[model samples]
Target: MRVLHIDTGLEWRGGQRQALTLHKGLLSHNIESLFLGNQAGELHQLCKNNHEEKYAGFAFNGELSLTTHHEIQNIVKEFKPTIIHCHDSHSAKLGSRFHKSCTIFHTRRVSYPIKFLSRYFKYKNIDAHVCVSEDIRNYMKQHFSNTFTIHSCVDIKRFDRVVNKTIFDKNGDINIVYVGAFSNQKGVDVLIKAFSNLAKKYNNIVLHLIGNGELLQPMKTLAKALEIDHNIVFYGARKDVEDFYLNSDYVVCPSVSGEGSSGVIKEGMAAGKIVITSDLTANKELIDDGINGVMFKTGDSNALTMSLTKVINKEIVIDHQKIKEKVSLFDCSNTIEQYITLYKKISNK
Candidate 1:
């Protein structure tokens, strides 16, 4: 089956990664797939370097302009894909314009509820609505009829091949890593506060803040104000995140808002590291409390501090093997199989 995946995001976030991974997975299975994204986007550059033959570019100005509409029409006519998968809001808007001629499937990666009529209409035009988490599906199901929940998957082999390099001091400093956008929704402030408290108690603790966003400088400022800037290292956005996952003692996802099954959680589990995440509906679905990973109260700095202390003091034991086994279900192969099934179902109709 031929598929066309479109994403208008300028940055390479979890959703963009998923789209690229899915395109690669589809190609491996001998299913023709192409990725169309912003010409100046990070995803476009990465895809051009890796999957150069299958990558397509368009000049997107964030909104649905006449140029974007013309480009979509040209691509649809040229590719003639059996399925057109929209990976973001902007792409979904463009996909909706061609819903009558082709099967349009939108993957909702965020858990935020759709309250606007225009947004609801855009979704209504989609042939199938695939949600990355149950929390997202629950929100979309209320308005759309063909909503399906498919959790995001990671390329586990990438994590497995990471060379374990020593990132921390040899004096046994507990290195904690947080890999996500530096935004209020991701609860960067809460993580900083929690890390500040932990750093005051233990001098051997360090927090590595990876990824970048509009709130990056603000988060760094907060670390300085807390007087824990020395304990936190801001890596901005790095391509070699597997190294951070491999060397860290723990991975933390301190999101205040609900996530659509965070890729950070899956990546940590795939690396066999203990992931400490906020206790939300979607997070609870992946983590079984103290079993595979641990969860703290959402947006609560004290709760995060306590969870961190548990790991530092050896109060919590992590079963690396069990974490790997649990994370296997979300492998990219399994996600591809499900998507193939969905594609067949839609194509038959």
Candidate 2:
């Protein structure tokens, strides 16, 4: 069976990454797959390099542009895929134009509430809805039907062959890494504040903020203001994140919002590192507090500081093997099999 994947995200976020993973997995299984993304986006560039003929590009500026719709429609006519999988909001909107012609499957990766109008029409047009988290699926079930919950997965092999290298001075320092966007939703400021407090008591601890966003400068200034700038390393958007993940003592996700099945948590667990994340619904689904990973109160820096102290002092012990085994179930191979089953089911209908 053939599938066409559409993603219009400008940045290479979790959704875009999942789309790429799914596309690669499909090709490995000898399933025909095509990708369409923003021409200027990072995903498009990666797809162009890896799968030139299977990749298509268009310029998208958030809103549903007529030109993009026309281009996608023409491609759909030419490709005639069994399933049109929309990976982001913009692409879902674009895919809505051809719902009547083919099976449109939209993957919801966020936990935000859906508008009544959009749910009744645009989302309703979708043949099957795939949610990255059960929380998202529960939220969307009220307005949509034939929904499936498929957690966002990672290629476990990518973390298996990681070459360990120090990103910071390892002078018996307990290094912690955060691998996501430096934005408000990600709660980078919360992590910085927590680290600032932790640094006062434990001078040997270090925090590595390893992604770029609007709040990068602001978070740096906050670190300086808190007098813990020396304890924090702001690594702005590195392609080689596995090195950082491998060398770190722990991985933290302090997101206050917009997290639907965190890839960081799964990747950290797959790497056999202790992952501490916000105690949100999505996070709680993956972590069994103090077993595989730890959880802190969302947006609470003091709680985060306490959680860090527990790990640093050996007050909390994590089973590295158990964590790795738990995460193995969400590997890209399993995720691809689930999607292929769904694709075949929808195609038959």
Candidate 3:
């Protein structure tokens, strides 16, 4: 069966990555697939550089664009996909517009509760709601029917190759890495405060932050103000993420707000590194509190500082094998299989 994946994100975040990966995976399985997405972002460049033949960098304009509506109608008529998978909110709404042509599936990654009034009609055309985490599904179940959990997965093969990058020049410094957007939701501020407290007593400590957003400058200012600028390194959205993971002794995801799941936690654990995250319900599903990883009170810098201290002081240790084995359950290949099965199951009816 043919499938069309629509992702409207202008940035190459975890959701876009998953959509692209799934499209590629379906093509490899001899299933017809096409990715219709924003012409902007690293995703657009990657598609052009590698798989232009299967990509459509559609400029959907905006939510109320008549041009976008007309274009989508034409695409649905010509492509006639059995399934249309919307990867973000904007595309989800757009996909719903032509639900009569094909089954609609929306991947909900956001964790915020929906408005009570809009909940009923928001996902009206969606045949299924594919949530990235169980916690997300549980919350979404209250707002929509046919919600299912499918964790956004990592490609384990990504860690197989060496990046040959130096993260630290020091002999035995403990390198900690945080790979995510620098936003209040991601808790970059909390991480800075915690790392500052950690760095005060530990000279051999280093924190590597990758990814960029509006908060980049603010977090940098906070780091300097906290007197931990020397111990902090900002790599700002590196393609060689595995390189940082390879060099890091620990991975920290200090998200203050809830989300579906974290790519950082998945990739870090997939690389067999201990992940330290906030005690969000979704995070708890992955981290077993100092077993596979460590969890601290959400938005609490003191708690995070203590959590980091445990790792640096040798008070916390994890079996890398256990970490790899756990995250392997979420390998991208497995997620592909699950999606294929779901697509066939729904399309048959």
Q: Could you give candidate 2's per-residue lDDT for residues 154-215 as a string of tens digits?
A: 88888878475755544236889999998778998889889888887875888887889998
Query: In candidate 1, what residue range of length 10 has the lowest lDDT sum?
Result: 164-173
lDDT per residue for candidate 3 within 1-349, as digits (tens), equals 9998898888888888899899989999999998898877678878888766689877768876888878877888889888999998888888887788789999988898866654656578899899999999999888777888888999999999865665554423778888999887999898889988888778778888899999999999999988888888888887788888877888999997866888889999977888999999888888888788889999999999998898878899877778978898899999999999989887787
Name the TM-score of candidate 2. Answer: 0.96
Q: Give all candidates' CA lDDT scores.
A: 0.87, 0.86, 0.86
Per residue, candidate 1 scores C-alpha lDDT tens digits across 237-265 of 88889988888889999998858989999
Q: Enumerate residue pairs that collide in model 3.
A: 211-237
Q: Distance from true position, residue 179, model 2, in Å? A: 0.9
Misplaced by over 4 Å in model 1 are 162-172
Worst 10 residues of 2 by lDDT: 164-173
Off by over 4 Å in 2: 51-53, 61-63, 162-164, 169-172
What does the lDDT read for residue 188 in candidate 1? 90
Weakest ten-residue segment in model 3 by summed lDDT: 163-172
